[model samples]
Target: MGVGVLDQTGATFAEYLPGMRAVIIADENTWAAAGAGVQESLRAAGIDSDEPVVFPGQPVLFADDAMVLRVRDILAATGAAAVSVGSGSINDVVKNASDMVGRPYLSVCTAASVDGYTAEGAAITVRGVKSTVTCRAPIAVVAPIDVMAAAPSRLTATGLGDLFEKIPAGADWLVSDALGIEAVDWDVWDLVQGPLQDAIADPDGLRRGDLEAVEALSEGLQMSGLAIQVHGTSRPASGAGHHFSHQWEMEGYGRDWAIPLSHGFKVGLGTLAMCALYEIVIGIDLSSIDVESRLVAWPTPAQDRARVEALQPAPIIRESAVRASAEKYLPPDAARERLERIRRVWPELRFRLAQQLMPASEVEDILRRVGAIHHPSQIGVSLEQLRTKYFQAQTIRARYTILDTLEEAGVLTDVVDRLFAPGGYWYGRSPEPRWTDAS
Candidate 1:
């Protein structure tokens, strides 16, 4: 129900869920790192704990069906309350599995890696498509500063990437509100924006693994989870950036690369892309927009499906993309109506969006300071790949974002091309030449 940020390990768990038998869930590495200590602490608090369920691998755990069932089976057999002892994947798996068993669980965060720890939904992959499955939040969150600060620096950097996304995520929310799609809840906005700014204010310390900085990052992430819980949606914490990440994950896009990106790492790159796109959106003169001409140029479903398939993503991803496109693609009249609304509110919308987002350069600087991957190249994604297919990410989600805005305005292609042009944010960073034309 609430999070407990603490300096001491193991002891805090007792205070939250005293005298209950628990089954600690962790991966091999986490069990060695903190799971064992957590078990010892539970004993000291007069709580009985079954032997920790340790999954094999140093590879990041995917919150998929197999993993969830495995954890659920253990909890069912043991009949003990669950205690997740790692970050992100572990927490999601345990949270969902605990919900399935109708048992309350506590989380002992091992890293400041993601904002899902205290959220009411678990991001899991079901049959190759990534989705946020509704689940109960942990009854209590036990985040020990020392454990989080000492976590692998990459994990912390990943957390920073996730935190940085709040800027563009909030901007997307503002845009959706302006379009009369989804209203922005200022209370939820207030919950995440301030903490995100505070975390970025001392990026150097966070990079160096300072306890205070790590704790701040952890608290901010926890608050983000709480904001989602309050809104009953991920709107406050996710947006176009997350959609991009989900697409990549569904396709196994970066798995074979030298450096596979984590969920937050991919989102960070998507965040940068969204911020750059927002810059373009702000400068557009809606008065010159010709909605009728654009509608005539819109691709048919077959043509769009061919474009998505050309990218050679997984079959499931391609199917999902086309399906979403069908739902999101607008007719000329609908497009004109949406464009008129945008035009009417351009002044207020521009001001609010600008206020909600940090400049892309500032976000990139913070990512660099925290040693996070800010470019697609770092994760082995070609510029052409992103330019050609990134818009499909928007189609895969019903959630409206800046991508949908551009699509509705019939300028997504032009904006994407500009993002790769000379002097653009991604220019000269790609290993290959830019696309010759917007096409």
Candidate 2:
């Protein structure tokens, strides 16, 4: 995790796969960044290895099911333990392949660009739908802080954007806790949330590639993944923000017409949207809810299924949405009780939610300063498409969140519509591009 720690790669690799051969997986860019040192380290540790698999760098590699199978076949044929040497996409491809072959792999991070470096599952695009395929975390992670802090602007910005996502994730957990749908996991909560603010506090410093700020960003991102690894669910780090990201991933969100978007950029824009939404959510007085009316208008299970069908995405994503929607639907009686809970806890819950979330404007400023994607259009997500996710994203995950809370209160549509209406918050904000590369 420190500077010049590529020297320790051999020790780390040996600790996990002693006497086993190393299978290096990297893209051209990452291989250039750290490949030579990794190969040299493995040999120094007396570990034999297969020739590194350096994929083309022209079109940045994607972690799709086909690529996973390709890498899995490579590893399976040689019977070597894997060593993934790239950021999110490369790591996910190798992680999924290693899991499929019944082996744990070590990760060598080229940049502080993703949480999945230490997360338990891989976010693989399967049949055009993004899914988190169950897999174990890397047995060992070797991140060079010096290398990360000196990496390109967009990469560090992505790390910061990924970490900022924890803010809204915490707020959503509060919603579920208040409604008594899912109890908060205090251990995981503290681990991910405790240092988030300080870590994201220095966007200017990070923009300048300052060592301390980058280190904080790096450590904070890894902790979020560690939470996922320990708790066995993305609940510790995902919320409506991730739902929005997942929606785009399924649709194959792109930087240009053909190039797919990075996970961090998707999450960054999603985090920005959710932060703005939270600003509106915290302002609404939940006590003003007309519970009796909501109970009268509450959807029956059949009606709930109908709504999901109407808003559902295609095939695989549709299947998940249907199953999740069915699992979380509540009867009129249960809806009434939940509405009552909201009315009772509205004040305190709002306070907690407000405390937990950063303002949308503040988050946007940080994003801009750090050179991350600060607007939806940068990722080719139109305001209308962004608007649809507010509803579509809710159906795909049964996990209780503010989205579910707003629905139970019978105001989800109203609140969401209000966000895009003229003169409303998030109505007309267009951010300019900063100094960032296409990659």
Candidate 3:
């Protein structure tokens, strides 16, 4: 029914075996990265070595439907209670596969890179469209601080970006509420938002591998999953930014020809853009607000065939987004008049955000920080190619995201170019490695 976190604990898998004979599912990379330690710990905890089953290849590369069926077959044949040995992609495969077969599983997180470790839904690319499949939340989230700290830096950065998304996503939820498109629960807002704010304020704690910070961020991720469970939809945790990521996943096209960013990273950029767009449309400053950036140096679309085949989004999606922007993100007319807010502040906010989230800049920084692919050239995408056909990326998802909103309002293309141009506004904030500045 919920999640349990085991910190500095070895052989945590031993606890799940009584429920069903455990089958530890891990991919090649994960097995190499953290499998031996987990195996040793499990053996020490009294679970037999024969219980673990390592899936072939990397989890991300195994998102194909055939792989899911293979995993399901393994589980059914072994009658093993599902347990995953990685984060994000691996967890998603096991979670979704287990749910499809009505089984419970536990996740031993090797990285703190995504909020999905405890989420009840799996983000899967099916038939080239990135969509969430109903799934079971991990019964336990087991990760030692040392193990998580040792994870790939970009993976940790991805987690930071995922946590940062709450600010804009929560705001969008409010916007949707105002437009009568969906109901917003203040309870859900307070539940996840509180921890998210704490994590952002003290991100340095994470940088130092502080147990409290790591635990808090992990909790926040689970809280987001719980929020979705409360709402019976992703509305409480995902919004326009997620839609943009889904669109890119489906279309496989990104401007500036950058490598495909993670879902969290893509949403992070979309959050900044959505926030800026909200200010532009609603006429507010919001400049005092500081949001962390999730840079994408070159984001070329990744799904070519799907992008060409999908239809443009429904018109109401855009209309609802605009109405939501005007009603929620922007102050109501009377409130704006009395509050003495400056509309001019919006342009400055837009430019600053655009600069900070520039694909090229993000690519360089991420590459330096995580040693991951950062350039469009590296990913085989070019600006000319994207500019000529990037519109296809906008059609992959049915969700009404910020891009869709901008397209509806007729400002998306211009804004995208202006934001990515040379000497364009780059508002990236300096990374502080300690919480001293936060307090």
TM-score of each: 0.90, 0.95, 0.66
Encode model 3's per-residue lDDT on 5-122: one tens digit a residue: 3321234455544535666788786777677766666656655445677766622444545667778888888776776888788888888888778888778887777778767788
After superposition, candidate 2 runs with Cα above 4 Å error: 255-259, 313-316, 431-439
* Candidate 2 lDDT by residue in tens digits, 1-439: 8778987898899888888899899999889889999999998998888999999997878778999999999998999999999888899999999999998899999887888888999988887677889988889999988777777777888888787888998899888888787789999998899878878889989878888888788888888899999888989899988888787777665634443456777788778888888889988888889988878788888888888888965776777888998899887777778888899999999999988888888888889888888877666567787889999888888887888888888778889988889866668866344323752
Clashing pairs in 1: 1-139
lDDT for 308 (candidate 1) = 59
Candidate 3 Cα lDDT to native:
0.55
Local distance difference test values of all predictions, in order: 0.78, 0.84, 0.55
Output the number of the TM-score-best candidate. Answer: 2
TM-score of 3: 0.66
Write the residue-wise lDDT of candidate 1 on 125-176 in tens digits. Answer: 7876667788899988888777788887878888888878888888888888
Residue 22 Cα positional deviation in candidate 1, in Å, after optimal superposition? 1.1
